[model samples]
Target: MKKILFIYFAIISLVLPQSQNESGYAFLKNGFTARNIAMGEFGAVGINDLSALHYNPSYLALNNKTQLAFSHHSLFNDYSSENFGFSFNLFNLPFAIGINTTKIDGIELRTKPGELIAKFNANYFYASLSSAYQIKNFYFGATIKYLYENIYIDDSNGYAFDFGFNYEKFYDNFSLGVVIKNIGNVNELKNIKTKLPLDFQIGINYNYKYDDFEFNPIIGYQNYLTDKISHLHFGTEIKYSQTVSLRLGYVSNYDSKNITTGLGVVFKKFNIDYAYVPIKYGLGDNHILTLIYNF
Candidate 1:
């Protein structure tokens, strides 16, 4: 059973989403919030969103209120993820924390084509602590993360870091951001070490207002160091009265999925967001929902 489980995990580590079979811990590449997902997973150049703790921590410097956020992501093949985020201030400095837990269940163990011997589950988790400092209109931030993964009876632990910079003084309606992410290493899992997905990303965005509606368009470039691949992210959002938003996004250079759409609603101190992505090859679809409250 252990040997089979090891083989299963080896295969899984190679085929997880967004990494193109080149790196492990692919779950780290997923979007942190539904709004971000709806906007093509644009992590940089965020505006006061606590989810920045996962993408570009430098954006956390924009936070002036205490906020809490929760999200659930449903993927194909009985895979799911739960996430939590919190942001607050201490001594006039902004800080945020994030947690993610993912599970893949009902994995079958069979010795023959028509026979099933047993079923098991695989789990992954990561926790992060982040903080940002602002100097004039420039923000700098860093994040430290602890990662863990369990497959049947074998488990490994790891650590990583993310650093980010944001320039918001260029214009009132424009912002630019850059980040370096997943800089660390993981322990060996069954005598084989898994490689982290190291990445560098840069993004720009513009906000425009007309009458009672506002428009935001964003573009980003991402480079995966390990996979030697590059991708482009594009997204736009239209908001009415600052209460309701319609979002559309597209990500280039993916084999399984690309286009995404979603919406957001703001009610007093609470916000609700949803995102949907249709996968190809009959692999079902991806759905994400997030709720946030500010105090």
Candidate 2:
């Protein structure tokens, strides 16, 4: 049974997304909202919603309204997550809070290949507080996060920090953003320490509008410092009358899958978004949905 458990853990370490089989806390690298996922997870720039708290907090300063958001992720291999976010202004500064919980149930525990001994569930969670400040057209932001994970009888906890900057004065309708993420440490689990997935990203986006129609195109580069891996992200969004949207995105340099698509609808102060991603190797597909309310 011990040997089987070890093998299971090794496989999990190799298969989680965006980590390149190099880091722990895979949930941290996953997208926090459906809109961002549908847009190739390109949140390093050109995002003004509460989802910014998970990517580039600098973007949070662009909105003046109080907002609340909730998201659900149905990922491959029985993995699922629920997320919550709240964004508001206090003391003339934009601040946001976010929480994520992930679970994998009915994992088989067996001593050998023949029979099952039992079953267990894995759990992961994180809570974060983020804030941003703006000077002229430049924005700077920071986030503090608390992370926890449990699998079988092993559990660990950690803390991390993220910093980001954005410049919106490039050309008309153009913006640039940069971010550094996962700068912190975690305690050991079962006498073995797990490394964080440190990352750096930069991106540019253009917002074009004519009458009641809008188009946004974005491209970005991401580097996983801990794993020495890199990837490219690109996406576009089309909107009509600010009420309906279509989004398409592509990611490069991944082993499993690359294309993503989604939709959005807005009515008064409420908005909903959905995203779809197809995974290779029969790992199943990913579906994400999010709802937001503004006050």
Candidate 3:
């Protein structure tokens, strides 16, 4: 089993982006689902079908069905990102996997003062495999990530690990989770001498149930360890009946565009999600659309 996993990971490494350089800014913008990004990237509880691989691996164990999700994002219609994720419970042991890519396409690497020198593309890709196991009131999980990147005359590649734990009371409305990412540099290549972008995060999710309606809120603190950038984020999912849902979120330090609005639907095994986020610094707004299926 371990060898198979290694082979699978090797294949993933071949296609991913190495987000390492003299400075590690590319690691900061590596992609994930926009639903999470809209919430200022606060994804700790992350029980959502698609984000299990990135945020909380324990969510895979809680689900018995298989899930697949894809997203399209427009960052002001110029630079954009595309993502895909899949997760399933295999052999009664939960497993999850994901793939994401960010392409800064349509930008000309200009000379001084807006003169076009040459066309360039800086892309980063991440592929991950994760698993979770249940133990009493807690679930412990881990993820292995493969990264790859190629830029103008410079290329680097590496691997990292993530660990997560979640605890929930059976009859309570509260849950907690903690996750740590970027554990080791399993395969460090040349010219990339820095450690991976590391992060530690804590999350809280609550659902207040009532006769007519229920409100679900999620709050989290994320600390990027290597950079010392700390942030707080929160979101609420308000639902009416079994059909329609609304979402809003806030994050303190991501940008001026902190608020988020989202719409959701559940129709048997099919789900559709949409999020609209306003601008922080640019002239255009951003939107993300996602579709998911669980079976």
Candidate 4:
């Protein structure tokens, strides 16, 4: 099984950018879903979908339903990101997988008229496999990922790992979650060696339920091993009739953004989400859309 996974990962890696403008694999920092992005990337708790493969793997065990999720990012029309995720159960244990691809388009070289080398394309790709198991009130999980990038004619490849744990007791309204990500540098560009951005995060959330409405308040802290920087994230979600939700989030210590908001709608087993984020430094704003199906 492991061998098959590695082979599949390799094939996917052949096909696949940045926030904070630092770190070797900065594209990995991009959120995979509008729901998560609107929630300040807070995934320490209250998450139970295939997107968990991009955040806290332990969340996979929270649900047994098979799920498929996809998202698209419109970043000022300069670049775009697409993400796809799937999760299911095997032996009563939950497993999840995902892929992300980012493409930057439209560039012109200063040429007299028309030059064959006037424009080029750049891309980034990520593929991850994750699984989680539960013991009593604790859930533990891990994910292995393959990272690849192509810039003009140069390309690079790398590997990383994510570990996560969640604690949720039955009949409890609160949960705690923790994750360690980008642990190893399996490979990199031959010319210039690089390292993944190692991160450690812990989050907690409390759910308040009454009648058919629900509200969740979340907070999280993230520390970076490579840059020695830390960030605080805050978010809230309000659900009505278990079909509609409104989300708001705030993040501290950022270069070009701080606040995010989103809306979500559920129909039977289908979920649709949208988020709006304003970019600082006059970069305009970002609009993200996500779709999910559970069966």
lDDT of candidate model 2 versus the reference: 0.86
lDDT of 4 by residue, 229-286 (tens): 7999999889999899999999999998999999999988899999999997766588
Q: Largest TM-score belongs to which candidate?
A: 2
Against the correct fold, how does model 1 do in TM-score? 0.93
TM-score of each: 0.93, 0.94, 0.83, 0.87
Q: What lDDT tens digits, residue by residue, belong to model 1 across residues 1-295?
A: 1224334645455434334447878788888889889888777775558988998999888665579999999987588999999999998888898999998777776655665668888789999999999998899999999999987677888899999999984888788999999999888776666788898999998988999999989999999887788999999899999999999999999999899899999999999999999899877799999999988
Question: In terms of TM-score, how similar is model 3 to the real structure?
Answer: 0.83
- How does model 4 fare in lDDT? 0.80
Q: Indicate the residue-level lDDT of 172 in model 4.
A: 76
lDDT of 2 by residue, 32-147 (tens): 88888999877899886899899999888876558999999998868899999999989999999999999877777665677777777789999999999989999999999998
lDDT of all predictions: 0.85, 0.86, 0.69, 0.80
Summed over model 1, clashes come to: 0
Candidate 3 accuracy as lDDT: 0.69
Error of 4 at 142 (Å): 0.5
The list of candidate 2 runs beyond 4 A from truth reads 1-21
Question: Model 3: per-residue lDDT, tens digit, 1-295?
Answer: 0111122233233333334322242443433665666555566774656576787777666654588888887766455777788877677787878787776554444335544555545576778899988887788888998876654345566787888888875448788888888766634333335456678889888878677677878899988776677888888877778567778888778665777777888788877778887876654677888888887
